[model samples]
Target: MIVRLGIAVRYDGDPLVDFTPMRFLDRFVYRNPKTSEKNARKGDKNVFRRKAYDPLGIKKLAVTSEVSALR
Candidate 1:
């Protein structure tokens, strides 16, 4: 997969600035090989996983943020 971060800035009395011309980075999505039909039937539907890398660590960050918000 590919990951990209776009930044846009606008200064007062100035033109809009866009940083979307930057190149995208490569990312990996992993799937559990052991997730079989039986597991799917048992409600183990989410077999895909994301890596915890710089710039965007969705897997770890999302879980922690959601848990904290529930408190």
Candidate 2:
């Protein structure tokens, strides 16, 4: 005779003994632009400027060529 058994599921806190590095690496290697900026206290916008541009680093580069998407 064959017997069937039910699968048991459980919830628990992170299994990793060291969660810090994993979290850091996840952000360092696989992070997205929006999230990275937010984490660094940088605001979001249409133009994305690199480091060295402070206060007014993001110059309006698309004003003369912005095409309306709704049009």
Candidate 3:
């Protein structure tokens, strides 16, 4: 019989993971030529830009989880 149990929780609050070099590489490799041409016609530069995670947003999410865990 176990009278007590221990659990461990770990949290990392970093948004840099969302901007990886591989994402840019993959985007260029997988982009459709037709789409690229259309975008170019519209004078859109810096194509294949990925949306990165917001630091404040991640912090809010972490705090919400921590609060629930305390309860």
Q: Per-candidate TM vs. native?
A: 0.15, 0.22, 0.25
TM-score of decoy 3: 0.25
What local lDDT score does residue 59 receive in model 3, on the 0 to 100 scale? Answer: 58
In model 2, state the lDDT of residue 13: 63
Query: Distance (Å) between predicted and true CA of 7, model 3?
Result: 42
lDDT of 1 at 60: 49
Model 2, which residues run further than 4 Å from truth? 1-11, 15-18, 35-71
Predicted structure with the largest TM-score when compared to the true one: 3
Best by lDDT: 3
List model 3 lDDT by residue over 1-71, tens digit each: 23365555454654476458886788889987665676768887767778676676445556568764675
Compute the lDDT for candidate 1.
0.49
Instruction: Note the Cα lDDT for every prediction shown.
Output: 0.49, 0.56, 0.66
lDDT of 2 by residue, 1-71 (tens): 12355656564666474468877798788866555656457555535566564444335344454552322
